[model samples]
Target: MKPQERSELIDALLDGAISEADFLRLEAELHVDEKARRDYYERLELTTLLEIQAEAEAADLEERIVPMPATGRRTAWFATAGIAAVILGAIALLSVVWAPDPAGGPLAAKIDSRLEPSATGFAVLTNQADAVWDSGGALTEGDLMPQGDLHLTSGVIQVEFFSGVTVILEGEADFTIHSPMEMSVRRGKLRARVPAPAKGFRIRTAEGELVDLGTEFGLDVTEQHSEVHVLDGEVEWSPKSEAMRRLAKGKAIRSGNGGGTVELSAQPGAFIDATGLEEKRAAVRASRRSAWLTHSRELRRDSRLLAYYPFDQPAHWNRTLTDESGSRLDGAIVAAQRSTDRFGFPAGALDFSPTGSRVRVNVPGEHRSLTFLCWVRIDSLDRWYNSLFLTDGHELGEPHWQIMDDGRLFFSVKKRDATKKQKDKQVFYSPAFWTPALSGRWLQIATTLDLDARKVTHYLNGKILSEEAIEDEYLVEIVRIGPASIGNWSDPSRDDPHFAVRNFNGSMDEFAIFGTALSATEIAELYENGKP
Candidate 1:
């Protein structure tokens, strides 16, 4: 096809006006033509960029576009020629937008790195929490790291240096990165593994520099003292203005700023392996589930059961869940796709994307106390409120269990009391817990409301994360909080202005609702059996 004809076809395709025959013809031509494919992609990229720019500058464009005087002589031809010239100019501008100059300053920079390659495979961000990072934000695997200081205020981080050296830093650790081969742990616990090629790795603490002589070691530093524990192989501990001491495997040395050193046997188990961090976490979860399965049958006999949804529906999504509870409050999966990878269960889980997906359950009546339990694998905590379970709209005495954007688990109840002559709805929220990195991992969570005791409790991995006592005004019982749901909540009132925000983007399984508040032991049992 001619260049002008090809451009017309591309424009029609972009405008969604291309006929089926023309689309097939264009597809066939582009399939075998390298230049045509290149042209198409370039045009598509340029068009998308121009559209975004146009949206941003729409007001300015409207102000600038003044009506032109009527011209009769070849007006259509002139307009067509002008549009052709604009298209050519846009194609030319594509290269600059697609690939900018390397040394064009930070404004034109795509990645923030100091190296010539812009990224040195210095270390992999295995796991992190509350650690100060650069503008690039939460470092993941394969993210390049330039030489800089890593400050950990009150959370742990695991990093695997490219040289096969893995290091785990405890809280309050001040670590300076000199290169991939060298780093200084000024404070807190630094457990590292230096393999054959990375033997010269050194850690400079307050007292002295400990050089790894092909070893695995844990070094701790405090205000007045420092300790080095050699787990495997050996390390050379050199004190400031003092003689070097060769510490062998199974040995530990503690030295104070003022005096003599104390030597003892090293505990290898005390150190965590950064490379196997995720694996260890998975193993612990597996162990918990294994322990719970032993008594799952006995625990299922709890008399306070209101509803139990195993989410074992196959093929079809919009179906009633197997309600083990005799109350027959069957739940349903709505607008959720069944995950292909079952994550080890025979029945696959329902994945709820942030597109207003949910599982609904309309409990018939109210209860004095309530409990919600489920296993969730969170994809992100990006939204202000990501619902795990919610009962209807933001009405009084409705339970809303959700996770805040900061990875904190929250449980709230909207209470409106008539006895106290309170006209406004008062919300009671549970104490927040700093959740660890929860992406792509299954977690067992349970929340309980005891109206008699006027307390709310939250559990994770079978242990209590937070507990809050319900205030007197907020101790109202849950009364017919209909339109119960999981993964997302919707407002019932058409006049309500607030948009439904917390659409969960993750997988959920084994959702259970109890009529009475579960004790700590019962909560642990639920976690043990239901963990994936």
Candidate 2:
């Protein structure tokens, strides 16, 4: 191969975008041509220097300059033979993938010309709203990363580095791409998954560096310090001004200008993965643009709306669910598993097992007209009554929604039937059609009680599934809405009284309560908007 052609192929290979035929040709040339091998080694050394420079700059350290060889050839500053051996042994890592930049521009233009071939980053797994690129240009998936700061004012992103490290970065965060194997988080929370070949991958923070000792970990950085949590394997935490510490699996450590501290428990769940990336993003967009937040003046507004729970919390063991209405009735989660819902993003929903896990919310006071809506995935029908929503009591006037043993949608409003001969209290039952094998998948449901009309209605996916008329004396006795619970009945008399009975065994997301029945049009819009 000619020198220019060989150089182009080498560049493409380093950048991870060379064609199969070109790669084969380059391999053959390197085996037969001594000069080609030398050129490749020189380029490798040059790439290393550029990587070190990028790392230094990203860490805000004083820049160190290395003079180029007089013959225009680059030699390794450390030992080249060892790097070459490792590179050859890990030849499979050379494969590259590239796609057109989303911003419709050349990805390499912003990179340094001399080290353009080894530009950092592999792909933009995610690019959420309002993320700003400070020095590196706006990036899309598959675009080569130019080493610089990525300042996200709002939104989250997942970036995959060429070294097989994946990082999910949260918004209000700032990050810098130092090299394929190194990065710096100035301010943000990031979850990183590093495979074996990328064992030495390092993340630098304001006060320390986390060297991946073959582990999946998370790093949160602030103006004063950095925190590290190892989810799996082990990691070496080296604080710039303190003694280095080794964090084993399930361990966490924090370092700042003050000193370094080791945490016994992964209490904050720093290493938890993002459960639902897409659903969480949708929830964010909806919350930001929903009529409740963005268009309060419009007629689409419903004043009776009490609470809206999107379940879009960060990736953590415990989260407080915020009520997005004028009422700031926050809910607390207890031992619930967070994961992707139908929407495919992290924190879209919480998973509850037969275990006592459930969410506790302060219920609003009872209203004449009430509506309850949520997205749920049932795991089974083992229990007689699988509760979905329930207030604290089973007394007259309190309302609850559940699924019957035969898979029927059940909703009840407390009332008395005076016609009973013995003066015995009478309770009514209204059940909707049973969806065959309706477990393990997501479904949208709404149950509404319109007191003035004396009617009870249930909706599946926005359309009415069943409706029933109320008795003449039927009255909703719910004086207080809460201390309400979700995913299980409020009955504290079961064998495992602590967890309640008939616990939901699947996921629930985007639950809401309103003081008025939602119009069919409004329900339809909600269903459409909430679709995954």
Candidate 3:
């Protein structure tokens, strides 16, 4: 605790409002927070100890009130002296006990010098290929089960469980394992290796849940969707809205971004450079997540010029990215990019229900005309889903939302005629496997579809990403639609899913989605003041 908090605890204890257990907790923090530690020592030495002595002496004034019998009176003097000797001996013993610091011991000293109970024993962030860690962070002994968090800033972190099972952490990772059967992926991505004699573990993400069955493989999870790549063992990717599919090594399934399951080989890198979507997953430092947020924000805000806002308000962000040097950031932000030249925030907040980002104001279901307009600054439009992302797709005939795995924004939709899209579409945009990468820099994205006309179109920064219709039965089914979700391109779980966390890294500002297709002038106006 901080010094102020610690002082309050002490005051509360002295006043009898707190119990002994409460005091012990505060005492533990005093050992951690330096200021609290020092203040406690000073108060004990200069004030409390002296004050208690005075009280004890005052209590001694009533000693004469005791009347002793003949034998008792004779014994009283000796008893008093004996008790005083006992007290002195006890004090001496305690002094000796407290004098031997752990730094002087053999094993105790060695361990103390090597290990520290920080977030993780080791880390490898995305920005650096080099690995870093504290000695205490690794499990030197048997199966080192972390009773706490092992931060994976960006990319992935792999752990070998005592049972010969392994677990891999995807970027922006934070999780707690309750046991082999239960765990929560507070954010980012994770892949667990389940050994025999175990039913595997239960993993939960911000999107949904997973129950593994002795699976040896990788799981890539972001705030947008979850991609499962089975390397060796068998596992099942289950979704609450859809049926569960059992997966074998080399096979993969996507159960996110509002659609149903799509099967693929779980192939190693294809979109590596763009989303770092490597075919084979690799290990990354736990601190890389922090670095990505830092850099991504800096790059984006420079593109926007901050006079206007992009994405949402400047909140709705909380996670972390720490550098090898231990510098940390809780939200996506640009440092010292505070020049007047910049016009928008890297990421912002909204003040509506659901309070989402990359916000679109619309009704859910089906609609005839739709438009999504948002402010954006781009590093590379060639990278997938730069500014805003939204999609309406389905698997095996159910409607869902689709999102880019990197947590950037992308655009997609269902073809109402359904059969046409299932046939004439590019494999990447087809019902079959193959995800697209939206490219360009600083382009505003505005996407829309006229359901009655069976058409689709996109506008980037202020240009077009694509405009076409694949035609599908599912597309025809969407009549009215939902509001444009801010901060995100799509929430697949909402309608369907990939991603690191619920928060995005790039800056997004002044977003809106309407029922009608907007012209290039209108799209550009979104970046200006009051352009509906």
lDDT scores in order: 0.71, 0.69, 0.45
Models 1 onward score TM values of: 0.49, 0.42, 0.27
lDDT of 3 by residue, 1-532 (tens): 6567778786776556877887889866764467776776676576565563444344355645333334644655445555676788789888887677856766565445334442432221222222123222422112234566655455434555444445555556667666546667756555455777656566776555666777555666666776777766677777757776788778987766676667779654421221242222222322333343454354343322211223323333432211111111112232212111122123332221121333333334444556655544332222233324333223222122322333233434433333533541211121211112121123345565556666665554455555666355435444344433334444444322232113233444344445466666756544332211
Model 1 lowest lDDT segment of ten: 110-119
Question: What's model 2's TM-score?
Answer: 0.42
Ordered by lDDT, highest first, the candidates read 1, 2, 3
lDDT per residue, candidate 1, 1-532, as tens digits? Answer: 7777777898899989999999998987786577888889988998996774454445457557433334552455345545676788789878876675677865434233211352454676666534444343555333444457766675456778878888887767677877688778667787888899999888787788888899899888887788999999999998876889999999999888776688888987766565445555455545644555445445456677777766656665355666666677777767777762223443457788837688778876788888888888777766778888887776777778888765667777766533445643434444544233336667788888888888888888789887888777666755445777888886634223342646887888777888888999978866655654
RMSD of each: 14.9, 26.2, 25.8
